[model samples]
Target: MTYLEKWFDFNRRQKEIESLLEETIAQQSEQSLTLKEFYLLYYLDLAQEKSLRQIDLPDKLHLSPSAVSRMVARLEAKKLWST
Candidate 1:
């Protein structure tokens, strides 16, 4: 196959992988979380490797602190997250 063909094939496979992984996460969580919500939870887990702080989520998620707070509150309301 030509280089461009190979690149296209790789991109196609990568997208398929991403779709499958996303579906898996949704099934595993069994929570009706938006993609952003799922990503926030993933980031929180990643933060545990160092230190987690309320202020850090804005930078990590590229959202305002208030936005993160709102999302957290929603998750808490669903009993997905706790203080």
Candidate 2:
């Protein structure tokens, strides 16, 4: 109930949730996608037309533009996603 205790509790829960999500994503996607990639696809699926500008992905996925571009390229290479 103290501030430090609350902070630690919050961190613990966050880690647990993140771990669970990673496990679920791995199982469901058959390890074909990383958590970030899964999130990218999820964001695109939620877009108005299932598309978003390359520049917009950095903010959505909290990655640098270059990182987003690289990830997109990898997905495209794998034939799993495209612009």
Candidate 3:
């Protein structure tokens, strides 16, 4: 009920959800995906025309612009190789 208690509860639930998501992704995907990668796809899927600018991804993914660029490059490589 207290602020500290509420914060702790929120944090605990977030961790639980992340764990469940990670487990499910591992079980379902042919190629292993990190949590951030999964989140990137999820965000794109929800975006207009299923597209988003790299500049917007850093705030959404809590990563730097360079990190987003690297991640996008890696994902693109994986897509090319998978096909």
Top model number, lDDT: 2
Could you tell me which residue pairs clash in candidate 1?
none
Residue runs of model 2 more than 4 Å from their true location after superposition: none
Q: Please report how far candidate 1 places residue 26 from its true position, in Å.
A: 3.6
Write the residue-wise lDDT of candidate 2 on 1-83 in tens digits. 89999999999999898788888887877447778888888888898978788888998889999999999998898787877
Worst 10 residues of 3 by lDDT: 74-83
TM-score of each: 0.61, 0.81, 0.81
* RMSD each, Å: 4.1, 1.8, 2.9
Model 2 TM-score is 0.81
Which digits, one per residue and each the tens of the lDDT, describe model 3 over residues 1-83? 99999999999999999999999999999978888998888888898976688789999999999998888888888892110
Residue 19, model 3: Cα distance from true site in angstroms: 0.9
- In angstroms, the error of model 2 at 45 is 0.4
Q: Weakest 10 consecutive residues, lDDT, candidate 1?
A: 45-54
Clash pairs, model 3 backbone: none
* lDDT for each residue of candidate 1 in 1-83, tens digit (9 for 90 to 100): 99999999999999898688778877887677766688788877787564567787898888899999999899999997776
TM-score of the candidate numbered 1?
A: 0.61
Identify the runs in model 1 with alpha carbons over 4 angstroms from their true place: 1-24, 49-51
